[model samples]
Target: MFTFEAEFFPDLTKTSVSEFCGEELSVLLHTLRRNGQLIEQLWNLVEQNGAIKLYCIAPEEDALEPRHFNRYGLEALSAVLQKSVRPPVFRVIGKTVGLSDACACENSEYYVLFSNFAAEYSPVSCGDCNLPVPLYKLPGENEDEFYALRQWQGEYKACDSLFVLSGVGEKFGYREISEVDSSLTRDGCDVCREMSQKCNRPFYYFLHRHISPLETCPRCGQEWGLDEKLHGFYAFKCDHCRLLSDSP
Candidate 1:
């Protein structure tokens, strides 16, 4: 069962975003890791441990449709658990209503769970994030969700203050690190692109399914590897529908 019995998140402004989108996204995932699951073994090794994070960004007003690309995080964790890598952490970040910068949320602080890798573990590199992410254009379609490459600030790594509870958690104690390159990704997924007439970010899997380069788009009931190639992709899933989706 997936359970999160923790409280807290990190400070995004002080720690800020990094220069690269991948690192920034990781840091974002780091903060959103507030209340999620963790693997049992990894849980024992890190100062704080649990499931890894999964994130999706969009106009605060838009509602998100799941994707296939999103499956990797969980699949990787499931593998770790099967191999007993350790209790992993999950940092799921969603943008409901974005403001300008960290103050965008005002004095109201945000939070996420944080954890460390096991002592006998290897750093798992988030693989090639080349797939597109779906932009939620439902509510904030008029706002024009923006994008940028961000990083954490220098000399001010006070992000740890958000989750420094005594028994609840402990700091990773790595370094006064600063800046993590993050992509201000908004509706970068494919399904969103098709609807927007190619005027937006890249497209990604909605309610993602792990398709080997050989697998098919689950929504399309497409057994591309088995018989065809999912040339005309689709959105969400309906296993009952036999690899088809109900996406708009």
Candidate 2:
């Protein structure tokens, strides 16, 4: 389970499709609705409660140090959000500090997070204000891959490092990773899955999510790398199906 869910669920409603579309991120909500796996995951999802509760966590495996949290969080999670699951632009309520009014619209907004999981200035809260958002919550067996990955990364501490702000490098790593992933999308296919899917013809190695950076290529039964070299040959062993070779 995403610690966010187990910890502060009341802040998050168990959203329905209509409920989902009601949020600021309706476009992405609709996209998730059309995709079977995404829909199934969200069907049982819950939301977190309150802004302040973000500081709470399960016990860390290592002793807590002041800088540890300051160093690792935000850097890691931002990268994961932008690279792995590009969400959409979420606007925050803005205020100008001494001026007693909101900041001007054009200058204050940070639309950088315009995809699956967005991070932007917190518009609503006063003082210690932020909105921690995960694009969708996957629950039960549907959440297995995510929980396993979190555990493997060392759970709370890892999550803090990856998602919270502790280090300079980790802060933008997720965004950097987003650039690396741009190459792996279906549009890069020389034959292109979109055209072929419409044509009702076979296509080259395609991918579906098993987890990050390791996806099973539907046509070839091989695991394509998420790195720069994925399309070149992509003969890596399938993590999902355990199949070998890109040879068809």
Candidate 3:
């Protein structure tokens, strides 16, 4: 048997409680835990309104579902609600600027963190070459900019970061005009060419001003740039022996 602690705003109206049961509630809880101001406000709200007893239960171990894995267990329910519900209950909560809305706004501000994580960690491969491609959505690009890029490219691919893509382009000689002209292609890689054509600039132009420091091999002290290949896995190829190792 397992027991979990559940907490809720005591003065929540029935409607608010119902709304909180799904995605809004999960987003709110995550925001509250992350934002210090919201946590203080939550404590103050509880102190003024008094605590409400919702329910208590201990379920048998065999009866537990996958959703129960999280300490709060609300996230699993929230995921289901987000799919079925339209516009999300949290949008309404945001408009009200109430206790819940404050937390939601904070959560919205940090949503890009998740986007960055997805860009870096998600499995991505080039459609034409079938090789793993490093793609990134640069920070400060809003949803509108993302959509505009997709529209310009005439196809949609799930890359958010431009820096990683630029790095890949530089390594493959795709962004160099001389190489493109010699090869009779605008870019070396199909993916790089598509992005360069859409942006009206060479892919290498997106490379960060400061290059990443070359990693030094522990065994031989050889320096090399990290490269991604074959389904987005990373490997460092030693400059000395051309040996490939997973770690530098």
For each candidate, give its TM-score against the true structure.
0.18, 0.16, 0.17
lDDT of each: 0.24, 0.26, 0.29
* Alpha-carbon RMSD to native, per candidate: 22.3, 20.0, 18.2
Q: What is the RMSD of candidate 1?
A: 22.3
Please, what are the lDDT tens digits per residue for candidate 3 over residues 1-248?
12223334422433344445434544544432221112211221122233322222122221123332333334533443443322221101112122111111211111100112122121222223322222221223222323333232221122223323665544433222212132312212343334444433333211111233225643356674565642243344443432233332
Q: Candidate 2, residues 1-248: lDDT per residue as tens digits?
A: 01111111122234333333244233322332222112112222333322111221111212122232222232432332333223322222222222122122322111111111221111111111112112121111222222322222132233234434546645443332222232322222332233234333322222322224434444444544444433343334343432222222
Ranking by lDDT: 3, 2, 1
Better of 1 and 3 by TM-score: 1
- State which candidate, 2 or 3, has the greater TM-score: 3
Best candidate (score: TM-score): 1
Question: On a 0 to 100 scale, what is the lDDT of residue 166 in model 1?
Answer: 25
lDDT of 1 by residue, 105-209 (tens): 211111111112221111111112212112221112322222210011110123233223323322221121111111111211222333234333222222212
State, as a TM-score between 0 and 1, how close model 1 is to the true structure: 0.18
Residue 80, model 2: Cα distance from true site in angstroms = 16
lDDT of model number 2:
0.26
Model 1 local distance difference test score: 0.24
Between candidates 1 and 3, which one is better according to lDDT? 3
